[model samples]
Target: MNPFSYHKPTTINEAINLANLTSRFIAGGTNLVDLMKENVVRPKRLIDISGLPLQAIEATANGGLRIGALVSNSELAWHPLIEQGYPLLSQAILAGASAQLRNMATTGGNLLQRTRCQYFYDTGTPCNKREPGSGCPARTGLNRMHAILGASAACVATHPSDMCVALAALEAVIHVQGPRDERQIAFADFHRLPGDAPERDNHLSDDELVVAIELPPPDFAAHCSYLKVRDRASYAFALVSVAAGLKIKGGIIEDARLALGGVAHKPWREATAEQVLKGHAPSEALFTQAARVLLQGARPLSHNGFKVPLAQRAIVRALSEAAFGNTYAGATP
Candidate 1:
């Protein structure tokens, strides 16, 4: 890692004051430290915000849950409230990285985790995300892990967060504090698509610090599933993943939530797809129709074209599992 000045702030205001365009905040250094070592990211200053009082997991007045930004993935996944109410989120968090890495990965840091690929990390190759205007080698190279939707010519890399996918389906709200004022951002508006600006990942400003993630309420606690498909069983980034939740009453779907990961620049969600399932009886054919609506307009890369169909089948499988409350996920050959 490059030489950088470090500052440990005990308060949130002090930590925000220490932040700037060239500075980066470090809580759980699981993702940031690796980027620094690979020379993919170099900050002039490192602001340590781990000591701040942002570690609480409390209940909101609206019967939802308020998860602190500094709460570790392991802690959040295993928390009684989370496991009992938002089991989809707990499953998604537990599906990421490893137990040791999850212990060091915070909720805020997970939201800000960068997209990864061979070209994005190797400084020797040209990657638009690493350096804007540079050509993206993944577009024509080994891109089995590249994006299939919301991908621009400038970048085909996909966000690698399993937690973010569940957050998208849960429709969580992110609260952030900036130099000027504090504001709340909807989960859908937080992560941005490539859209010629591959360098910018999220809507969070450089000086802003994410305070907490507010989940509205638990509705699909009994009917939810998190499915991750990867090269191996454990510690592997997803090739395609699905987070599905449904509220069924009297054999009819009342409400539905579906979000896809490892297939787009951000956690992919389409309201129309969810709408297709609502008010309909849960069935295999209905789930397949919903999957088709979700995967509409998906444009695949050179080597990752299989992701399109794989995501479709995975969506169908996830929705079926959610409706039936089963544990079976995607079946890969």
Candidate 2:
């Protein structure tokens, strides 16, 4: 790792003031530290924000939940409020990294985690995300874990956060503090699609820091599921995953929120599929149709084309389990 100066700031103002073009804020250092060790990200100054007052999980007046940026993944997953009110979020968190890593990964850090694209991690490879104007080797190389939706010619990387997938389904709001002022970014708009500039991951400015995340009122706690499929059962990145939450009334779907991970640069919210299942009865046929609608415009890469069908089946299985409030027979498969 490159030599760097470290600054531990106790206040948000101090953190923001210390941030510069060559500085990066470290909350849990689970992801940033790995990238730094890999030489993917080289920072001259490391601003440690763990000393700031951003570790609370409180209930909002509007029956929502406000989660501080420093809340650890393990804490958030097992918190009473989260487990009782937002089971999907809890499940999604538990579906991610190992227990040791989760204990050190923070909410804000997870949101800012980089993609797990092999080409991007290997500095010797030609990855546009790592070096702009360099060719994308994943475009024609071994790329089974690449994206199947919202990918561009420059990048085919997939976002690796399972928590963000559930957050996208819940429509959480991202609270950011920058040098200018504070602002709220809708979860849908927080992460950006890989357009021309694939190097930039999210919409956060260079100097901005994520303070907290505000979740909307809980509505699908009783009928929500997070299903992650991969090569092995435990501690593996998702090949295709689904975060499904549905509100069913008298055998008909009242409301639905669906999002897909491991498929794009950001969480792929299935708004079209949700619309199709809004007033329909929950059944295998209906769920299959909804999955079909979700994957309508998916443009898979050379080796990742199987993701189209795999993601569709995962969506169907997740919706089925959420609707019936029971695990499906082959949900994991």
The local distance difference test score of each candidate is 0.92, 0.91
lDDT of 1 by residue, 289-324 (tens): 998999897998779989888888888888888988
* Highest-scoring model, TM-score: 1
lDDT of 2 by residue, 95-184 (tens): 888899999999999999999998998998888888999988898899899998999999999999999999999999999999989999
Each candidate's TM vs. the true structure?
Answer: 0.98, 0.98
Judge candidate 2 at residue 112 and give its lDDT.
96
Error of 1 at 254 (Å): 0.6
Candidate 1 matches the true fold with a TM-score of 0.98
Shift in Å, residue 263, candidate 1: 0.4
